[model samples]
Target: MRSYHLSHSGAGLAGLTVRTHDAPVPGPGQALVAVRATSLSHRELLVLEGSYVLPVKPDVVPVSDGAGEVVALGPGVEGPAVGDRVMATLFGVEHLAQRGGSLDGMLTELAVVDADSLVPVPAHLSYEEAATLPCVAVTAWNALTGDAAGVRPGDTVVVQGSGGVSLFALGFAKALGARVIATTGGPGKAVRLRGLGADEVIDYRATPDWAAEVRRLTSGRGADRVVDVAGILHDSVRAVALAGTIACVGFVGRTAEPLDPRALFASGATVRAVAVGSRAQFTAMNEVIAEHGLRPVIDRVFPFEDAPGAYAYYAGGTSFGKVVIQGAGSPAGIG
Candidate 1:
């Protein structure tokens, strides 16, 4: 099977190249998937840049989000039969009772996922769409619901940025009937976010103190939940909530700043850093998505051979939704 691997240059994703390799045969308890499509998240940039602590091998396959069909299953694998449509969860382990470790990468024409890590794709979703769910989608779900911390109706939730995780948060929050407040750096995105069911939108670029605006919008009550994807705005997050739960999931700003412990103490708020989510969470999320017929927003799809180009497009940050690379001869399905 044809595959793409990291080049020797260590030049990040820009160093990725396409190459032909023998199709992987399933090993014991594993399954070989005929990958249909894979989606990109901003966090992949961290992996490519070697900033993430995962310590990826120089020539290892990149990416951790995709959907495919079971072509074959290894010995003792009976759950997913051949031709079953499935998506790979980030962590092969279903439910890690504790935190640590990372999920497998899924950017390729095919992937070898443990059978237990696969989630059945909803019959209503296409491979391209299902490809978008595993990583960011599950992370958003866990942030809101997986920890037994359910977001209730009428609660005010804030989502920062218009990226994959934030968008998922907005969608999930909306499904729970929670009022959503989304922030975007672009004015156009603010409009788009409102259309995505956000009750309110803030243009961070126009209003640097967007968090304060969030507080004002809530009549000084502050948001009940804030999903912070913009690391630079962490302090802003601290300013916007009254005893809110803040889930830090990204570092779009790429800088570290001093945080006031007093602020958090004063508000009696909790700040938690999320590293995506578990396979169990992925399964739970898929169920909700299928139930709601929620289709993930896909910004663009590139041919498999042009996977590198897909990364370039993602780097440009021009897309409003997920960017994907479809496997050869595979049909596009946006879930």
Candidate 2:
């Protein structure tokens, strides 16, 4: 099987190398998948830079999100049978399972995954779209619907950035019937975000105190649910309404300043950290996506042979959506 591994010969973007390895065979209770598509995540970049919070193997396959057809099943497996289109992540069963990080990921032509880790792909989505869900989409869903932040119709949601989790939050919040306030630093993303159902868009670069704007947009009540992808917890405290919830999804800003205790105490809001969700949440998210015909936005897709290019492109900081890699021999734009 052909795979992309974290290379030892270089650093940064140059560290991804395409190589051939023997195809994996399924073990008992496992399924062998012919991976058809994969997508990149911000953590993958951190892994390459040796800065990821979780430990990653030097040679692990480089992506956590993939969708494919099951080619074979091991002795104990029953369903998601051979030929079924499925999506998977190590996060499926064990929240701590880290495929594409500590374990071999799906940046290969074949992946032998735990049978129970697979889920049927939403019938309405193509492989490329399905590939974008396991990480970002699930995390976004958990942020909005999690216990602390049960986003409701007529509630206001603040999502930061035009990246996968933020964009998915925008769509999910809209589908959940909440008004969405999206924040992005890129000059070109505001219009695209408004088109995607963001009730209002703010450029964090132009308005450093964007949380005040979020409060202004909500007529001073502040946001009812804030998905903190931008990693500014103090700002989230200032932006959330009294008794509102803040889900800390990521810190794309790279620096997580200590939160001010005074501000946190003043907000009277709950703060929770959100990791990628469980299989049950993924299933529910897929059901909602299917009901709403939600499409995962793809900013760019690279052919499988160009995995190195794909990784580099995603790290370029210009993508406004998910970056995907088509499976070997698969048609481009499979979505």
Candidate 3:
């Protein structure tokens, strides 16, 4: 089996090196999956830069999102059968009942995963698209629909940036019948955001006061839910409606400013910090994705050997959606 490991932590793609290892057989209650595709997230970038709060062990597999087929099952594995398409749950076994567990990332050609941690992929989606769902999609679902912020029909949602979480938020909010206002950095992404179901797209670069624009678009009511993937907490506080919810999903902005207590009090909005989610949440998200026929937005796909290049592209920050890397064992037709 071939795997990409984070051999060193630095500022560039040089840290990730491909290495060969003997594939292992699964133990009881586990399944052996031939990895088909894996996707990158901003979290991985932070890990590479040595800025992430969670310490990644050296030589660890370094991507959280992957989809593959179950090739074999160990004794007592009674779930997915051979040939069933499955995606990994980001968190490891212990996190299924708790919060804040670390992920055993999936950047390998083959993985032996706990059978309970795998979710069946929808029949309509390709391997690459399914690979995008485990992290961003589940995180978006957890942020918007989880206990932190239960978005109702007719509510208004404000999603920050055109990243995976923001785009998934747009799609989920629209599916829930909420009016979505999305913010992006430029005009080109504004058009793409609208096409992805954002009712109004704000170019944050042009209108630095995007919170005011959100208020204007909402006729002064402000947004009921703000998916703050960019970590612009102050702006999210300003744009959120009174008693609304702000789901803090990312730190892409690298902002260092402390939250103003006065602003939070004035808005009366709840600020919830979201982790990716549990196996239960992942399953629920998959159900919703299948129900809505939601095909994850994929900006590009790279071959397995070009995994480092995939990280480089993601670091360049121009991708409109999830960037996937196809594994050596991936079906040739998928992409």
Cα lDDT, all candidates:
0.78, 0.87, 0.84
Model 2 weakest 10-residue run by lDDT: 7-16
1-335: candidate 1 lDDT, tens digit per residue: 67777653246766786777788888999998998888888757766676754555556677778888899889989789999999877766545311112433566666777888788998888888888888788888877875445688998999888789988999999988899988888878888898889899988789878778888899988888888777754565555566678877777866747667777778777777788777677777878787888888889999988888898899898898899889888865534
RMSD after CA superposition, every candidate: 2.8, 1.8, 2.3
lDDT per residue, candidate 3, 1-335, as tens digits?
Answer: 88777774453477677789898799999999999999988877877888766656666778878889999999998879999999888876763421111434678888888898889988888999999988889999999899744888999999988889988989988888899999888899899898888889999889989999999999998999999887889888989999999999988887736789999999998999998887888888878877999888989999999988898899899999999999785774352
Residues 227-313 of candidate 2: C-alpha lDDT, one tens digit per residue: 998789988998999989999998888686789998898889999999888888889999999999999999998999988788889
The Cα error of candidate 2 at residue 158, in Å, is 0.3
Looking at model 1, residue 73 earns an lDDT score of 88
Per-model TM-score on C-alpha atoms: 0.92, 0.95, 0.95
Weakest ten-residue segment in model 1 by summed lDDT:
95-104
lDDT of 3: 0.84
> TM-score of the candidate numbered 1?
0.92
- Cα-based lDDT at residue 169, candidate 3: 86
**Better model by lDDT, 2 or 3?**
2
